[model samples]
Target: MRTRTTTAALIVAGLLLTLTACGEDDTAAKPSAPPSLTDEQRSSARAAAGLPPEPSTTARYKFLEALNDIDRRIVDGKDDKAVSRGLNQCSSIKRASGDEDKQVELVKQTLSRFTIDTRLPDIATPETGGEILAAVHQNLCPDF
Candidate 1:
């Protein structure tokens, strides 16, 4: 009787192990790329997050062109960085809530932070910084 009970226990344990192994999804262990969102979905997401709609491809190209014109170093092999900084500036502008003075200050700070001269302790000059701000506003976040 004891031998029979031990066999039954072993069978139950084996069955449980087999069931647990089968229940696992092999695909779950592998990483998959995220689904691409449609333009409408992206717009809705931006709206829900309180961010302005994304700039058009043409607008982005123009923005990069303007940045390149202002100072090649700003976009030279750093296009992504420049674009990110502009977007951050736009967010700052929104937070400023139409305070022109605050917006200007924020732009200046952003320019200084991004375009600071490595050798010198100086930031971008007022003219260049103003151009950067203008490009960002006109292209990336005109509504803001």
Candidate 2:
């Protein structure tokens, strides 16, 4: 019984040491900065707006790229996981501070390019989605 207890104690100590060692590696590693906007990102958002690049274009572009990745996964007929991932990406951007509404409007405008049949199911809501889109439209095409 003493031998068995010693072995168990060693095992527990080994686990604790292993966990401690693993944590130190992360401490040494630097946290990555957010990605900058690629040329494709700027073009896509601009395409949707039919206007010149805006001030928040880079940050906006990165947000859109994340959502686009989710969208590409969905278009490939991946599964509900892909669709759900897209929804979550949208939610993340909408939830972010500092011009979230503008980002949301960019998303709506991008989706508008797709045919009604090709679009995501109820992509924007009457409140969050519609309001943002309306503001974008009001600025871009106020003649309407």
Candidate 3:
């Protein structure tokens, strides 16, 4: 009886182990790429705002870097070079707006239209493009 019981226990343990191993996979989940606006989408957004489309990846990175800086500044309460870089990038948008507050508002609305909620730097939850754009405008365009 003892031998039979021991054998039964061993069999159960082995079966459990096999089942667990079978369900397990060695592959890791791939990280999703950052969401960005398409050229047409950007162009449409710009047109809606009465501004030209901003399609430069370099500008995109600068915008992202500025977002990063703005995020950092919010926490640390100090300005940095990223602030300037980001403002400089927005200058084109400002120029397109013809120095009117409505232009900035239009750009912001357009950004909101195109922005998606995804993993953004320093944000615990997914952030939107409008949120980032607002941050830049709020921080740099004080008059607006």
Candidate 4:
């Protein structure tokens, strides 16, 4: 009986020691959260990447205005939606890495997905796709 008790105690102590060691190793190996960038640092990084300044109110307005000029129906009663779409386009553009064809195709796909007019055969043609690409570039990410 005494031998059994000693063996059980030894097993319990070994388990506790193993668990404590694992906890310490896990705490040391865990990564710390990355530091947040200040606005100036963010701007500098953007500039270094040849990206335009972050979109502002004026940029959003210009995006809407350009889209409205292209086809009023594109923004009809959906100004905020259109702006959000345009910003999404800007993100796609940045990812495209100067591939104009991919950029235009992305714009077309995005427009087709978002356009409310289901009756239209095609919401985006090459012409309008190019225009949309240009608009997004000019108004949202000029340097991209």
Candidate 5:
């Protein structure tokens, strides 16, 4: 009886393990790239804002760096570099308007103490890495 019970238990356990293993795939893929915003969408946003269109990523990053400097100034209770940087960031946005351009403006306004608040849509939840991480997430991360 003991032997039969042990065999039954082992067989049931083996079957369950096989079923679980069968459900997963080692070849499961990562997500595909997100869709790019359409040119019409970009054009409409630019028209509404009376701005030009999107600038290069490099220009965007430099502007974001300047904006973050503004935040550091705020934390120090003095609006020094942040104001300058934030305004510079906004200047960079003058030639662009769309999702990406909107994001650029959001960064500028956030650090510039504007009445109209805007934030980037896809910010990764903040951790303790400090300003550099914040900048990278804001500037480099897609849609950040």
Candidate 6:
């Protein structure tokens, strides 16, 4: 009886130590924030926008890159999957914009403007999928 109790206590102690060590490693491995853009990149982005240079321009460029990436994916034939991802990206931009109606209006206007590019494969043209992605980039990166 004494030996069994000691073994049980040792097992419990080992489990507790393992759990504590696992949690500490996870916390240490947490990802750091994204790095800021260099001065040259920021200046070029501002020049392209034809606006004054500012720290926020970096973020705007990053945001535009994200939107464009989705557009590329859509054009690459990912179709619905790209649309789903783009919508999520748009939601983040909309939240940042604090103008849901304006964003929606811009998206609608872009969709109306671009139509589907017929050069793409039929699988890449899902009703208004092409237009929707164009709309997303337009609304998200109006400056660009």
**Candidate 2 TM-score versus the reference:** 0.30
Over 4 Å off in model 3, which ranges?
1-79, 98-127
| Clashing pairs for predicted structure model 6, backbone only | none
The residue-by-residue lDDT of candidate 2 on 1-144, one tens digit each, is 999999999999999999898777565478788988798897687545443334254444443443344344223444333333333334334433267676655555434433212555544333434433333333333322
lDDT per residue for candidate 6 within 1-144, as digits (tens), equals 999999999999999998897766566577898999998997797465444334244544454454456455333554434344444445444444667676555554334333334433442343345455455545443543
For model 4, the run of ten residues with the poorest summed lDDT: 113-122
**Candidate 2, residue 119: CA error in Å?**
4.5
Q: Which runs in model 6 stand beyond 4 Å of their true positions?
A: 22-28, 38-40, 43-144
Distance (Å) between predicted and true CA of 116, model 3?
A: 12
> How would you encode candidate 4's per-residue C-alpha lDDT over 18-136 as one tens digit per residue?
88887664576668999999999998986665556667888888888998888877788787777666666666777787687776577566556446335344555667766777887
RMSD of 4: 7.2
Report the Cα lDDT for candidate 3: 0.51
Q: Which stretches of candidate 5 lie above 4 Å from their native place? A: 1-35, 46-52, 56-144
**Model 1: CA > 4 A from native:** 1-28, 31-38, 112-123
* lDDT score for candidate 5 against the true structure: 0.47
What is candidate 3's CA lDDT for residue 21? 91
As for model 3, its CA RMSD to the true structure in angstroms is: 11.4
Would you estimate the TM-scores of all the predictions? 0.63, 0.30, 0.26, 0.54, 0.26, 0.28
3 or 5, greater by lDDT: 3
lDDT of every predicted structure (CA atoms) = 0.77, 0.46, 0.51, 0.73, 0.47, 0.51
Measured by TM-score, the strongest candidate is: 1
lDDT of 6 at 89: 42
**Off by more than 4 A, model 4:** 1-54, 116-123
